[model samples]
Every structure is written in structure tokens, then in C-alpha cells.
Target: MTQPSREAIQTLVTQCLQEILNQRGTELSAPLTADTPMFGTGGLLDSIGIVTMIVDVEQTIAAEFNATVSLADDRAMSQRNSPYRSISALTDYILGQLSEGA
Candidate 1:
């Protein structure tokens, strides 16, 4: 199987965020910044919502790249940084996984 491209990964992340926002449709006083936390204080994703995002990301990566990515695995989960923190962070993490698969 081939690795996922950076562009594809970015699209997936953006789609995940947008879908969640669409469902919740919250009245954000201000648009969320790139640095905004995603799973903690000021985080946009609740626990259940996080699962949805995760499933969507994984499935999209698999289908789009013809490769399987398990971000829930040991190395990813143990990282000093959390991929779920922000869109940029998640993009980098997905790219790293694709690189490893390559």
C-alpha cells in the first residue's frame, strides 16, 4: 500500500474539524485559532466527539492512501505532544505516520 500524501492528510484534518463544527454549530465568539486546544480547556472536541474524529481520520487515510494508519498505537499515544491538540499538529502527525509506512 502507498503512503498518504501531505495534501490528503491536511484535507482529512480539515474535514474532520469542519464536520464537528457543523454538527455542534456553536456560536463561537471568535473563530478558533490554530493554537486553540482541541481536547482540553478551550478544546472543541468532547470525549465522544473525539472518537468520531478519530474514526473519520483513520478511515479517510486508509481509503485515500490505500494504507492503514493506527494513531492510537503505542508510539503515537506516548508522544510528548498530542496530535489531537490542533489541526497543524494532527497534520504533522499523520504525515509522520505516512512517512513511516513508506
Candidate 2:
């Protein structure tokens, strides 16, 4: 199977985040972007929100890409830069995981 492009992964991530936010009836002061912070200081999501987003992203990836990935795995946590730091970071991480599995 062909691995998904970064843009596709990014779109998926963004969709998952929006879905999660909508479910919780949360709204952001600004529009979501590649630089939008998902975790850490000034982040949009709290710990529980981040976890929920991760799980939703993972499941979406599985269904869309036919690839199963653990977004919050040890490898992700051990990275120098966190995958959960921003939308772009998470997209890159998911693309990497899909590439590896391919």
C-alpha cells in the first residue's frame, strides 16, 4: 500500500482535532493552523483533551490509511521534540510511522 502524503496526514489531523473540539463544544480564539499548539504551554488542549485527540487521530489514520499506529508510544515520548507539540509535528510523526510500516 502506498503511504499517505504529509498534506493528507495533516488534513486528517486537523479534522480529528476539529471533531474533538466540536464534540466538547469548545471554540478557539483563532483558527487552527500548522503552528497551532496542541500541547504544552498556551496549548489548546489539556491532558485529557490531548489524549482524546491522539486516540481519535490514531483511529482515523487506521481507517483512512489502512495503517495502525500508536501515537503516544514510548518512541514518540522519547523523541527530542514531541509529536503532540503542534499539528504539523503530529502530522510529521504520523507520516513517519506510516512510512515505517510501509
Top candidate when judged by lDDT against the true structure: 2
Worst 10 residues of 2 by lDDT: 93-102
Question: Residue 85 CA error for candidate 1 (Å)?
Answer: 0.4
lDDT of 1 by residue, 53-100 (tens): 878888987777777778678876677788888877888888887787
In order, what is each prediction's RMSD in angstroms? 2.1, 1.0
lDDT (Cα) of model 1:
0.76
The CA lDDT at 15 in model 2 is: 92
Local distance difference test values of all predictions, in order: 0.76, 0.89
The C-alpha stretches of model 1 lying farther than 4 A from their native spots are: 1-4
TM-score of each: 0.81, 0.93
